[model samples]
Target: MDDIAAHAALIAARRPRDARLRRVGVSRAGTPLWLLSLGRGARQALVVAGPHANEPVGGATVLRLAERVLADPRLTEGADATWNLLLCLDPDGLRRNEGWLTGPYTLGRYFRHFFRPGFREQPEWLPDGAAAAALPETRALLRLQDELKPFFQCSLHGVDVGGGFVELTRDLPGLDRRMAYAAARLGIPRELGPYDTLYWPRLGPAVYRIPPPRPRDLAAAITEAAVESTWYHPHRHGTVTAVVEAPMWGVAAVQDGSPPADRDAVLHAVSDALRHDTRVLKRLLARVRPHLGGTPDAARLLAPVDDYLLVCPGLADAWDPDTADPGRPLPALTAGHLTALGIAGRRIAVRTAGLLHQLVTGAGRDPSGALPELDGLIDAGCAAYRDDSGARWIPVARQAEYQARVVLAAFELAGRHGARARSGEPDWGTQAAVPMHRE
Candidate 1:
């Protein structure tokens, strides 16, 4: 079969025994957008694919859930149990998502290579006023949701390295119980549980807003600035809907090249977490914000991005170093350095620094111990800068490169710890335990 046919077949094979496959639309790049539906098609459940590209995990998860739902004869037995699963909503974004989609399964390697935040360089970011009014993918989703009016409209997304957690629209209601249950079952950190901005109850899940898009009105000097705006979830059409974020750190398993069983063990643990809590999740979905046609003021929704920019060492004196400043630049920071900086800031950085310190001090630290931390620093730094690479205060891209260097050090530490751990002389202090410099 040709590539298109092959893709279709993969979706078909993965579909449950009674589901049907249909082409939803063509991607901007001309690739096909497909939809998988099961049951009687009443549109009671809807799972939308995210912007695709660098993060196909959301699409993959949707597909995986579809397969499992179809296979479970008990749950899918009802005629009224229908779902609309959009596969590859943004094929244009997905085409560029090669490495992570096809690469080896390691979070560290995935972190080093997968880069998509600076979407200006990306093709899919091109929907101008005309395209925005009717981008092929966007239009299709809009029309479908209008017609189906699904009970749950979940836009799937994967969070980056800095942190991982689940989110729900504050206006939509709480799935805290479901989320907490899943995290515990998956063995994900409890601290990673659901959270939200106390100020804007309407922004939905805090995780969905993670490394949120750079605010559009920031200083022009920053190259990697994010454009912050509330997205339109079709379910917001009084359909009782919102987005679902499954952070990568929460899903993908990593090790120092451990056996497949070990990796699968971790993946399944997460999968089970989501699966077991489905009933609780169903209960939570009954209360998303009722759609109000008018959109909210962007400015009111977004605190100005200027506050988050990271300043360079030169600006160090400018920013009262005594106050915890997200924008202050750290020329060459390691995980240890981040912890030290955090220690200096005291309480503000303690949460993140403690997590880093724990991983570094693990008895059998993975060979890529630094990988996650380095990813966190880069994420926090960029987030702090709101992606402004040109900010005079700091050169974010350069700082990012320097942050990568810290990741390399952590990698070496991980390798050393892994070697010793395998040999049964795991030393959590010297090899595994790297302390945060206090005072």
Candidate 2:
């Protein structure tokens, strides 16, 4: 958000002269992909940002981290590892969001300028199938992975609002405590609801594991994994993938501890909401069917909203209610998570609905009333998003700092975990308070 190119240059200028910046690959749009490397230790780690264009907070965080490592060799000092940080992985998509990067960031402005890579298009997800590294940017990352074979890979991402949390492939001991403390120090609450736990195991209050996707043979990959895909997790087993989900808003709400709603009621609401979303999407698609001739990546554009209505809810339904109950009088933070989900759901709807409106209204700078049946729905959704008072835009630098702290802790934890792993120690996934660094 804070001029990624300039920041990259700044890192290059300020970094210890021994640190090296190398062009790893290029994005589809010809943006040069770069990695800043330092410390040639035995172990290796890869930190990436801009995997999702909409979540550039991670990119800023990664840049800040480069500064920290360069200034104090001790940050990565004792931990014997080589680090390669890829700044802004999806610059092509990020550029699409640059309009709002310098903003009086309001709810409306953020969504209007938003665009996240779909599952199939995401670099992290693509490596699983026939289309491995299909995107030029993805190929660059894959090359980096092949060359580095990192013991850890972290994707920096921030959520719209809820609370701060982390998703890991294999649970690392004591990392949860570190994350909770990081959130506290940042003055953010840890999300308590099972929004994510519906899919992954809750390690601690806010920390979760990436839920393994439904059986790979579940007829449809997109439909199945749409809800909870650990595609990035198992890509290189024994390697850990860590994600930091910081919130842009929903600060006080996260601390709420109210009793939740009934499980049945939540399921009903989810099914009904998604079914409605699907139906509206179908109608909009039909209306604009003729106009979609040769639109680039139209299918990919539609995959997310389609998956939202069909596969996503089915996965939620399959959750064991006795063990995982996500619906409730969600504490302020939990409720904020739900509110964020609803708003995100509608963003997809609006994206498609807007296109439909454009087509019907002649789809140009000066158009007529093309929004026939969808007008009220679009208007109502906008009002609902504005109603959530928990929304606050955390400055990019603040978020980056918060994220940077978590990562440093992760590096130490992972180093300890790796050292234990090499010694044939018990899985750290379930262990607690073991020595942080055994090597």
Candidate 3:
């Protein structure tokens, strides 16, 4: 079976009873793109799916939730009910990155293999204008969303090789609580914060921004939803919104070295936070459902807060702030920004090229080279692993892959010429790391 059918079968096999499943679109190869719907209530519901090609869990989670909603008929009863659920929004990216979707060989491998930074220079993620301009998968989703006018919409995505962070359309004061709960319930511990240290004037609320693309194209416009989801179809009865992002697997892995007591303490704290936060959000959402007359909240449910907490500290740093501006054209990256990203299509492709050379050619340090500072970052990140694992030497083969990529990229960025000469193409056969299964 193809990727979609395999996923669809997984959903069907494990899916709850009341959920409805159907094909929302077809692939370029004429594959049927499926969507699962749960809950029958007329109240506006959600369009939650996996947005990034690399992160399939969100779509899985949404399908799972639909099953749950279908089984629990009372979930949408009375004034609290919302709209009908919309299934996985984008299957194309999912299909494209199906290798990672197979199962976790290593989380780090999953990220580096699909290392499509959000910047213009990022060949992987940016896509050719034709594909980016709204892949058949994306356009079909927009059409469905615009026609249905759901209450709320969320896309599941992830960013590995960085810190954990959550991107929300609007600030939810208690999101920290919900996140803490997810971590605590899952037995992981990692603080979430801004991705980058810099800020922009107009996009004041964001932590970091990617640089602009040089030849601005329609794909850029599609990414920048002006008034949230409303930009897609201004005349729609209600708004259509999105939160494009990647999931951070950092939350559940904080117990490697803690005393049993300390580990429990962190878990308990996160659990307690989640419990309260979930309750608050459920209540808040319950209140909003009736107001929209069965329409999704779109952008209405989010409450802006100046002191919003992030799920990961380094979420925003990967891409420069200047590039993220939908308003500005993608920038012509200076040799500097390219130098910063190392390899895998970020800045500094040259340096990263050199590192691959060393790995492939088995070379040593070059005389006139400036190695990437990624080594220092990797060292620091190693410290983090040790701290979290209590030096238990948890099998971080997954993390090792991530470290390898970082090291490889940095070495290349330092302009190690001899190494660069011998760099071979990346091997895409490796599997992505699955999240660790903890008891």
Candidate 4:
């Protein structure tokens, strides 16, 4: 959906006249915040896609869901929820992603076009204050949630590598079974321990349960506070907030079930990489900050790293694999997870360097002198990402279909009045039965 207006028009043509489209507010740059709505059922459900322009996997899934529901209004018959569809929630950032959206959806292409905001400035975690209220997109979402009080709120997001995983407010019954089936059918693996050591309530290989954020966690630092925007309001507790994380590139190593031989070693390696990236990026950023006034997308690029450099050390300090439910098997990762972990850190440095390069060129300066060592770092990181991403790419349409299936299943599972399924008792203390993937 690079040409959002064009896609929006196509969606409008498919849906009935009852479908509504309007600008809810304006983006920071004055781009209209648009929403499309269909169904007037008693229960309200809101689906958000492109919450982060860098993660575009859900863009097609959201559109397909809207199209299906439009063609057969009964698609949501049992759920009895009015669906508010918000696509490209951050068009200002998304437009910056157009360079890679139309191409081969490779990891490198994605990183090249990425423009994620800082955790605090992101749609989900924007600090609640006068400044936040002034953010038209943030305000519009808050207004809609307050007005509708949705029964379900799901934000669509994706990852750079690995497989698919779902995050829900509560551990619902039978959702795991459906999620596993959908991912297997699509030939994608699950991310065993995503970003944080969140492997818990092991419903299945890829399906996971995410608890509500605590006051302490939010207070610890902004990194801990980067809760989904849906959590900002009291109405959120009663609602089923789900996050679907699909990956751009995946491999067999992604789903390795075996535990690492040295958990401490693996944890330290990734944490060190993250911390190193933060320091390196911070130094480069200080040099580039004064010169950013001339770049086309300076703010978009600066926000992520500015926040990242400040909070990364805290995140690394808190890493603990022992806290995860050992009994529940992780979907994938072993040695490969270490590589991916390092790449995540490298991407941050690469992104900052690319932006600095842009700013320097715009200001008519030679990049080598202005941003010494940046080109080498970016080039080295990119070479590593390419080496890892090779032969691991999936078609965007296939990824969408699998995501839609999992989401639809979740809708049924989370419905208040809809048929509920069996809840499996999890064995929280035991070693994983499956072996890890080792080359």
Candidate 5:
């Protein structure tokens, strides 16, 4: 957190006349949230970094992106867009994840220090009465969104282990293809399987359309709330919202589109593994419930576990052949896809155990009597995941570069489209001839 603050300060200081940095709001922990605004164009482009606390790659991406745009006037001038960059949306949660920020970048180390807020706690996905009820960080972002009403918005996010992918609220012509090509240039494989955004419609290779909200029940409503903010910007201002998902670790399997020899068996096995991990997490949570004090932080710590417990069952059920519709065949299940699923489940369990271990041993507590079970669970889970996934650590700089290119691509697409609309030109479905930035 200090490093990010210092970097932001340095960036602002470097270009004092043009770069404007100010405190937007205070986090739940009283940490100041900063927004750095640059450029002087008619259209506004908002780039939010580190919306998910666990995904710290965006921290580097935002800093580098700010520097790139500030140095290259053509980027801002040609795009005709003023860029508003938020360094980190969830500082309080991010502080919890700082242990692994400067790291060996191994899967075990990453999972050991991992800290992801529950869906409800995420700044991007606030409920209806967010102004009063949501985290101060979330409210700050909402205020920014309302104030900027940007024509282009990109939320920088990443996965622990998988091929890179991007999700767009609107299919902005050739932007998806361009972003995928950029990531590919960086040797980041396009995620071919349905890993994170399972039901979202595929717009192109490694590009997905963010699914629209369709809430029929409370659970569905909660899920919708988690993603509603992505649509909020677009629905109000026709903003082209792009979610850049870079992977921390690259799995060659995720790039392979071939179906497993026995697809149903693979799916069922993945489902069984997830179910088992869910059960383990539930048991661990139950054991730690007594130690958790009556505090908001404690609730925050427990929320992800509760969310996993709630959602994992349905997710596991969906993988069952008996439950899936026969008419709608399942997508190709690659070895990498199955590995990603297994790793995701183990990640949840390990993270839950990690947090629980912190609570039990934190605050000058005696280490000898602390919960050994929690430590064991975390260590075992991390080792199992590391050994099984066969995932390679992707450098932070590489991930940031890939994400920066994606953001730039979005900018070019939006600028071209806006220019066309202004001249009363028809919406020609031709691709934008934006120059790619090679490292």
Candidate 6:
């Protein structure tokens, strides 16, 4: 974080008049959250990086984007949007993940060092109580939102493995295609089938309309109440929020939308893989539960594992062939679907193992003898992905470039239309009438 602060200071110094670095809020761990403001235009755009600490690609993207705009004024010369870049929203979590920041960029190192906060700890998805007592970081973002009411907002994100995709809060006609083109220009493969998002309305290839809040029950209602996503900023300020997702590693299968020859086999295999991973984690959690004391950090560490156990069964059930409707034929399962499922299973397993390893080792005692099993699990899970010959490491620079281009595309679209008030719930079926511009 000191390095990030120093870098931001240097950038601000370069353009003393136009660029200003301000401390927005302090992280839960007391690290200062800094926001770099650049340009002076009629509209405002907010670019957030490192929302999920494990996804560090956005951190690099933020730096590249700030530099790009500074180097070439023409990039945003006529675009009437002032750019506000938040380098890392969750600095505390990012610090936990610094182990692999300076890395060999291999899958083993990535998973071994990975750390993601539980849903409750995340600023964007804070529960109602948590939101009421928002983390300093969350408070800072709220203050920024109120202050800027940005016309366009983008939260940069990346997957550990998969093809590239984008999620939009408001559909800007042609923007998805343009963003896909930008990513393709950088040689990033587009995710054509289900990857992380399922059931989301696809605007175009690799482009998805983020589903609106729909709480089904008490639990869902609480979860919905906690969703303070920048995506929802559209409701308050008519902001068009776009989330750009790239991948640290690329899998060719994620780019293939063709249905697999053995659809039932693929479904069964994916479901079994997830169920197996969930069972492994559940057993490990049971072992570790007695050791974990009632502390915020302990809860935070356990949350992901607990949540996974709760959610994975339902996900697995959805894919179970016996559960499918007899009258309605199962949707054609793509090779990408099978590949994504396998990757998701490996990801959950490794992440659960990594977090549990931290808890066990940090407990200062190991009476349960779970450490050996955890170490083995971590190694095996990582090797499962790393040893795959089909997986290819994606360079950070290339990923950053792809993200930057998407940001530019959003800016261009915004500038062409300009900010306009959006009334009522957004009609998902139609393109938003508001114009978007670049910063």
In terms of TM-score, the best-performing candidate is 6
Q: If scored against the real structure, what TM-score would every candidate get?
A: 0.48, 0.80, 0.47, 0.81, 0.87, 0.88
Q: Which pairs, if any, clash in model 5?
A: none
| TM-score-based ranking | 6, 5, 4, 2, 1, 3
**Better by TM-score, candidate 3 or 1:** 1
Residue by residue across 101-219, what tens digits does model 5's lDDT show?
87876666676667788777778874555445467887788778778888888898888777788777666678767876787688887676545655556666667677554434445
Number of clashes recorded per candidate: 21, 7, 57, 6, 0, 8
- Better by lDDT, candidate 6 or 2: 6
Q: Residue-wise lDDT of candidate 4 within 185-207, one digit each (tens)?
A: 88877765454434334455555
Candidate 5 C-alpha RMSD relative to the actual structure = 4.9
Writing each residue's lDDT as its tens digit, candidate 3 over 304-408 gives 100111111112222434223465432333222221122112212212222222222222342222223323323333344335323221123332222222212
Q: Which candidate tops lDDT?
A: 6
The lowest-lDDT stretch of 10 consecutive residues in candidate 4 is 427-436
lDDT of 4: 0.64
Better of 4 and 5 by lDDT: 5
For TM-score, candidate 3 versus 5, the one ahead is 5
Q: Write the per-residue lDDT of candidate 2 for residues 99-216, one digit (tens) a residue.
A: 6677878655565555565656666554354244467776677667767778888888877655677877667768878877877777766665535443345566666776544445
Instruction: Give each prediction's root-mean-square deviation over alpha carbons.
Output: 21.3, 5.7, 21.7, 5.8, 4.9, 4.6
Q: Tens digits of per-residue lDDT for model 6 on 240-343? A: 77888888888777777776788778778778877887887788888888987743378777877676566677667766787754664344456776677777
Residue 356 in candidate 4, Cα distance off native in Å: 3.2
lDDT of 1: 0.38
Candidate 6 wrongly placed segments (more than 4 Å) = 129-133, 216-228, 292-296, 324-332, 387-389, 419-439
